[model samples]
Target: MSDIAIWLVRDDALPLGQRLTAALGATLYQPWQTPGDSPREQFRRCFHQHRQWVLVMASGIAVRYLDGLPASKYSDPAVVVLDEAARFAIPLLSGHEGGANALAYQVARLTGATPAVTTATEALKPLTLGIGCRRGKPLHDIERAVLSALGTRGLAEVREVATIDLKADEAGLLAFCERHALPLRVISREDVAARGWTGQPSDWVQQNVGVAGVCEPCALIASPRGQLIVPKTAFDGVTVAIVEDRPQTAVRHEP
Candidate 1:
């Protein structure tokens, strides 16, 4: 009877569903467990009773089941969809108003999946942190480098963390992003090499990582419409840079 419900149609998804249930403190509902009621009926009951939902199945199935149930953004429960592979956590409904976007991030943190947030509010967030570190660098070093780069800026302003795809699986970087609840954006090495960067290139990086630089170019690529506020700064063995998006001013129309 938790406020959150996790529904899975397949037995294969049960493990992930259980993990999500434990992490999110949600009730897991399965087909066989529905007493006398059909899975769809159970889904309907959960939909109305819960404040949030995690649907672990194909998006089409979730959509088919949810077709006529959504009442309003304000009243409808937030819904997050995850594939059986658990590679992506998507906020399928009520992204901004119903807290699905935040829930998706939480799921990603728990599963090491990527949170696919499509909301304008999340996209327009001002700051992006670009980070690079040695292989197997511990979380504390990465955290220190990022904090130093942030300086006076707070973590709330940060939209995402950007890193070269080579470092996408870096444990330290992942831990830092998870700790801060920041989505990690992985930029391809080719894209980073093709882009222009401001700071002096690193010889070691050129030879070892096959890139001229990691932090600044990653920040630039991740925030295409942004300006680099902090150049590449190193702490221990980790490098960190920050980018800030140019503010958009809305036009006021005179009637």
Candidate 2:
């Protein structure tokens, strides 16, 4: 489970905070209940303690508590703010890399509120995971290896999975992708080779798969504008690769 800390400062927000804790399986911290630490101190402690934080209070209060701790989006913890009424969830900081937008969407789904997601990538859901494994590899092993590799970069959600066309009908790969609710993309060998992957070369892979490595090339081909965030990492005959879609630059027309 991702490390999450849910904070509540008002009695009216208690039920919603508890619901989030139960639905999302997060740690709920009520500073009043603890009765020792100041609100700012509690916020600082929670910020350092968790990867994602949900503040169940006014947005201004949330902003004030986080006053001096803002870091770059990639390194900062995701922060979501919901009013005491829980009518809406807003991803206040670190919307994409820190996963605040996705967390807000999840909170809205559970609480019957609206999620105000402003991040372009989170709205598009363009990330994909590329995988390769030996025949009959266990689904659990593939899942574990992929999670382990992606967790290092703080990316847990993938919109889809890509692999060579030869593995399209592979039962283990299909099952693994299906279990995660991600679409499976089967890439042709020619498409994989065109990407010019720089991953580790293997004689056995070249002989069998017609490519240097399956995971790296497939990920690159599937997400053309993406950068390989995590390169091919192998465990127990399963290899996992991650690619994140790069933010597109806006083109201005000459007036």
Candidate 3:
């Protein structure tokens, strides 16, 4: 089940609105339903009930309603503005903040429409990795882990790690390592799960066998997803992480 929903406003006779909805649903590969021919008040009431939905509005009238409604935590949804013709897809209000940018792309892919994705991070070819700490996740979780890992022999000389380096790309990591004079060795099973993550090493482990010669256990490993776990003993120092995706679903976990 998706925590997202789509709202389509259209003329009763035209199939453009419904077709666009179908296209977006097909591309997302997730179940999404449209509230057909409903009044604006009813739509607002529906949105108020569910907060995580991504509303795809296909009309100027709906957009007007969206503009007039004051921002409220319980009422405003991540709105995606689609022209009636679906000729162009525009992600206005909640672009990056509300997952609107991703929703826009899905709309484009489904309807062969162009998405007006203006976020610099998405526009730039960058890797986006998000490290998550379960148990009432706090920023301190990542901060403490990085601070703890910094003192390890391999990372002692490193200082000021970029939070964004964890983006879903390698260049970010490489750049962070280069900027800090320290080695950001990949956390291997030996380093991440000396006590557990056992079994024959995978191809990735074999390739990075000795990339840094500094084999120390990673204090913590984080991914975009919110999965996390601490392995017993020391590990190979190379750990795989997860990155952010369309729905902002960060599934960080221990392997």
Local accuracy by lDDT, each model:
0.85, 0.78, 0.41
Expressed as tens digits, the lDDT of each residue in 1-255 for candidate 2 is 449989988767788878889888899887887778797797786687788998998888888999999878988989999877767789999987788876776676566445666676544675678888988887888888888888855433576677887787688887886687555666667767777584787677789987888988888876778999888899889988889888678987899
Clashing pairs in 1: none
Quickly count the clashes in candidate 1: 0
Q: Write the per-residue lDDT of candidate 1 for residues 1-255, one digit (tens) a residue.
A: 898889999888899999999988999888876569878877876688888899998889999889899989999999999998988889999988998988887687667566788888787679988888889999888887787788898888899988887887799888888898777877777778888484979999999988899999988877777898999998888989999988558888899
lDDT of 2: 0.78
Compared with the true structure, what per-residue lDDT tens digits does model 3 show for residues 1-255?
345555544344136555654544422211233456446665655654533333445546656656566485334556666675555667665666666666665565455455665555444322222221222333333434444443332333221122211221345344444554322223333334433222233444335442221121222221222222222212123332222222344888899
Candidate topping TM-score = 1
Best by lDDT: 1
Question: How high is the lDDT of residue 9 in model 2?
Answer: 86
Off by over 4 Å in 1: 131-157, 162-231, 235-239, 243-255
Give the CA lDDT, 0 to 100, for residue 47 in model 1: 86
Residue clash pairs of candidate 2:
none
